[model samples]
Target: MRSLEVCKCSKTQAWYLFLVLVVITTLSFTGRVVYLSLGEGYGISLDPSCKPRRHVVFLKTHKTASSTILNILYRYGEARNLTFALPFFDHLGYPQLFKARYVKDFERNPSKEYNIICNHMRFNLPEVRKVMPNQSVYFTILRNPDQVAESSFSYYHDVTPAFREAKSLDRFASRPSTYYSPSAADNHYARNLMWFDLGGDHNAQGDPSYVNSTLQALERAFDLVLLAEYFDESLVLLREALCWPIEDMAYFRLNARLRLSVAPLAPAASSKLRQWNSLDWSLYSRFNRSFWERVARYGAVRMERDVSQLREIRRRLGATCLRGDAPAGAAETVPAEIRPPSFGTAKILGYVLRQDLTGPTRELCTRMVLPESRYLSLLQRKQALIKLPHNMENRL
Candidate 1:
C-alpha cells in the first residue's frame, strides 16, 4: 500500500509540471501573435488595393536633401504595411554591409515583407543583392562637385575635430590627399563624391578611373538617375515609376541650415577653386550634361510638367510652410557694435579653409586669438531682445 501511494504521487507531480509548461508556451505564442498583428496594422488605413512591393533600394547621399526623401519613402512603406531594411545608425560606415536578417525574418513568420530600404550606405552591389534577390530597383543622387566641396568644407569646419584647431581653408585644402586618399578619414562629401564619380572600389592609390567605372556600373544597375539640382522633378519621376499614390509622394522636412548670403567670388579665387577640385569638376560637368541630354531626349516638356505637379503637391502637403523666412522687424538688422570685425582670426580661418590660399597676406587677418568678446556680447544682446515683450515697441 505504501509503494502504490508513492507511485501515484510521482505521476501526479509529472502531470502538474507538464501542465505549467503547456500554459507558458501558449502565452508566449499569443504574445508574439499580438505583437506581429500590431506591427502590421501600424500606419495602415483601409486601402485593400495597396499591396506591399518588394526589393527596392535607395542610396542616400549627403547635402542632397536625402533625409527628406528617405522620410517620404519610410512613410510610404508604413502605410502599405511593408518592412524596410533600415540602417543600424543614422549614417553607415565601413564595408557598407547590411547584417539585418530581413529575408530570414520574413520567411519565418511571413508577415508583410519589407520592400524598401533607404539609408546612407556605401555602394556594395553584392551585399545588397544578398538581401534582395528578386527584381530590385536601385537609385542615388548627384550634386555639383564644386558646391558639394564648398558645403562640405563649411560643414566640417563647424562640426569636426580635424578642422577645429586649423585656422584656414588653405591648410585644409593642402591636406586633401589626407582625406581624399584611400586610407584617409571617412568624410561624407569626399567619400560620396569619390564613390559616385569613381567606381565604389578603393584602391591603394586614389584613381579617377575608378570613378568612371563606378558610374558605368551604376548606369548599368539603376533604372533611373536623379540630379540634386532638380530634386522635385526626380521625386516626381520616382513616384511615377513606383506607381505610388499622390499622398504617398508628399515630401518630408528635415536638416535645414540657415542660408547665408554668398559673397561674389574673386577671379583669382574662382580660378584656384577650379584647380583645387579639377577632377571632381570635370566629372560633375560631364555627368551633369549627360544627365540633361538624357532628359531632353525623353522630352523637356514632360519634365517641366512633372516639376510643376511636384511643386503643387509640395504646397498641398504643407512642406513649403516649414521653410524659415528672414526674421521680421528692425531687430533683424545687425547692430554696428556687434557687426563682424573687418579683420580677425575668424577671417583668417575662413581664408585658410578655402581651396586655394596663395593670395597676399592683406586678404587675411593675422590675429591668432578668437574674437570671442564681440561674439559673446552679440549673443547676450540677442537673448535680451528676445525676452523683451512684442508690445514693448521702441524701448531701445
Candidate 2:
C-alpha cells in the first residue's frame, strides 16, 4: 500500500506545492494528496484535532451577501452527506412567520434531526427549535441599510409597491413619505428589510427602549452575526466558532448584480436611506461594533493572517473551477440550467465551469457556483431519494 505523510516545508517549497495542487485540480487529475498537515508556516489548518461542526442554522437574510454565505453552507453540508431542513419550495414560507411545518420533512417526520437549516425565512425561534438540534449553532449576516435598500429597489422594482411608485432609489430616499406607506403591499422591502427578515417590525419607530430591547433579543437568538462589509473577517471568526478547516469556508459570490444595475446613492440620499430604514440601521450599527470586538478577542494579527490564507485559497479555487481563470469568473453566456432566477429588473450573474473538468473536480466546482434555486432543487431530490422506500428504489 502506498502511504503519504505531511512534513514541515520551507515557504518556497510550500508555494511550489500549492501551485502544483492548483494545476492538478484544474486538469481534473485523479492523483490524490493523501495528507498535508501544514501548520502556521503554510497557513492552512487552525485545529486539525477539532471535529468539524455538523449541526448548523444559518439565517438567510436578503441582499446582504447572504446568498454567497448560503452557497458556502450548501457546499459544506452536501459534501458531508448531511441532511438539510429544506423548505417545501424555495424558502420556508417567507414573508410569513416560520413554523415547523414550513420544512418539507417536518410534516412527514417531526422527530427527524436536520444537520443544517440555511433557507430564507422570517425567523421564529420556537419553530426553528423544533426542527434543528439543541446544539445547533445559529448565525446570520447583515449589511448596511443603505446598500440593502439600493439593492432591493433595483431587484424588486416591479414586485415591491413602494419601489415601483418611487421609480428611483434616490427619489424614494428624498421623499420616502410620498412613496412609502405602512399599509402598502410588500412594503417591507422598501424599508428596514433586514430587520423585517429577522422577524422584527419593519414599520416600528426607533424608540430608544424598543430598539435596545430588540437588539438584546437578537443577541440571545444568534451565536454569531456577520457583517457583509466585513465578510472575510466574518468568515475567519466563523471558522473559529465551528472549528472548521479554512477550505470548507471558501466560496464563489452568488446572486451578485451586474455593475451597471447597481444605482449608487448620493451621500445625502444614503443618509436619507438610513433614516428611512432606521430600525435596520440601528440593528446594523449595534452588531457592527460587536463584530469588531469579537475580532479583537480573536487577535488582530491572527485574524488578518487567516483571512489572507482564505483569500489565497479562494483565488486558487477560482483558477481551477471557473472559466477565464479570473478570481470571479463571469459566465460568458449564462446557461439556462444555472441562470439565476430573475427578480424584477436586476440581472443576477452566474458562472461557467471549464469544459475539461471531470468527475469529483467537476462536482466540487459546479457546486461552488451553482445558483441557489438549482442547488435547492438538487437537494430536494437528493433528500427525497434518501427517504424513498428500499423496494421502490430497486425498481427505479
Candidate 3:
C-alpha cells in the first residue's frame, strides 16, 4: 500500500512539471518570454521585442505624487548618463510660462537634445518640443481636485496671498471669491491650480464648450495621463508604454506630509472645494476614466500581476536601502543636508539609508531618497563636469 501511494505522488509531480513547461512554451510562442524560478513559484512575463524608451517628458504637476515620479526619472537618467533639460535653478521658469530659453545654457546649445525634462513647469508644448527630441513621449499626472486643494492650502498657506488671508482651508472654501483674486500674487495656488499648472487659465469659468475644447487639446498633447489615486496601476501601464523593466519604476514616496499636519476637510468644505476648482474637477474626472480604460486595455489580470511584482520589487529594495518606517526620523535618521526644506505648515519628510551601505550600493540607495533640491544640485554639478573636457574640468 505504501509503495502504491509513493508511485501516485511521483506521477502527480511529474504531470504538474510537464504542464508548467507546456504553458511556458505556449506563452513563448505568443511573443512573451516567461522566466520561472523552480521551487520558488516566482515568474515574470515580458515582451522580448520591446525596446526601452529613452526620450521622455514628464510634466511634473504639484502635490500629486509628482515628487516620487521625479525621483524615479532622476535615477533612471543619472544611471544611464542621459542629458537633462535642467533649469538655471531648481525648476524651469515656473509660475511664468515655460520657454526653451528658460533651460540653463540652452542659448549656448540651441539644438542640444535632452533625454528627459521632468521638472516643475507651466506646460507649453511648442516650447517643450524645442528642448526635447522629436520622438519624446509626453505624459503627466493628475489628482482628485479636493485632495489637491487640501494639500495646496496646507503647503501654500503662507506662500499664497489668498490662503494667507483666509487663515484656514475651511475659511477659504466657505467664501473663496472673497479672498481669491486672479491678479493677486500667488493667487493661482488658491484655485484651479492644476489647470494653471497645465498652462490653462485658472480663472476660466466652467463653460462647457470651452472646457470640452481644452480637454480635447490636452488629450491631443499628452500620450498618457496618469491618475495619482491609482498610482501602482498607473506605473504598470507606464512600464508597458515605456517598455522599461519593472525595477526601473521602483520609487519611495518623497515630500509627503505628516498626518498631523494634514488638515481635515469637513463634508461641506469638500463639496465647496470641488465647486471652487470646477475646471480642475472636470480635468480630473475626464482623465480618471481614461486612466481606467488604459488599465482595461493593458489587461486587468496582467496589470494586477505586474503591479504585484512591482510592489514586491519596491518592498525588497526598500528593505535593503531605506532605514526605519517611511517619513522616518525627521531630524536624527537623515543627514541635515539631504533633509527636505519646510513648506508653509507642511512638514515634508524624507528617508534615511542604512549606515552599513558602501560603494555603488550606498550611492544608489542615497540617490533614491535624496531630496529634490539636493538631487538637482548633484545633477547640475555632474552635468556641468560632463560638458567640460578633463583638461578644463577643474575651472568650474
Q: What's each prediction's TM-score?
A: 0.57, 0.86, 0.87
- Predicted structure 2, TM vs. truth: 0.86
Each prediction's RMSD over C-alphas, in Å, is 19.2, 10.6, 15.6
Indicate whether candidate 1 or candidate 2 has the larger TM-score: 2
For model 1, what is the error of residue 365's alpha carbon versus the real structure, in angstroms, after optimal superposition?
Answer: 47
In TM-score terms, candidate 1 sits at 0.57
Off by over 4 Å in 2: 1-43, 325-331, 390-396
Which digits, one per residue and each the tens of the lDDT, describe model 3 over residues 57-170?
A: 999998899998999888887766778899999889999999999999899878887899999999998999899888888899999888999999889888899999899999
Query: Which residue pairs in model 2 clash with each other?
Result: none
1-396: candidate 2 lDDT, tens digit per residue: 112222344455556557655643453312122111212244555576777789999999999999999888887777667789998899999999999999996886799879999999999999999999898999999998888888999888998888889888888889998988888778888889999999988888888998999899999999999999998999989988888777777787888977777878899999887777899989999999999999999998988888888888777777777777532323453455766666787877777778787776767777777788888898887666455343332332
Distance from true location, Cα of 336 in model 1, Å: 34
Off by over 4 Å in 1: 1-54, 94-113, 158-162, 165-171, 174-184, 187-209, 261-283, 319-396
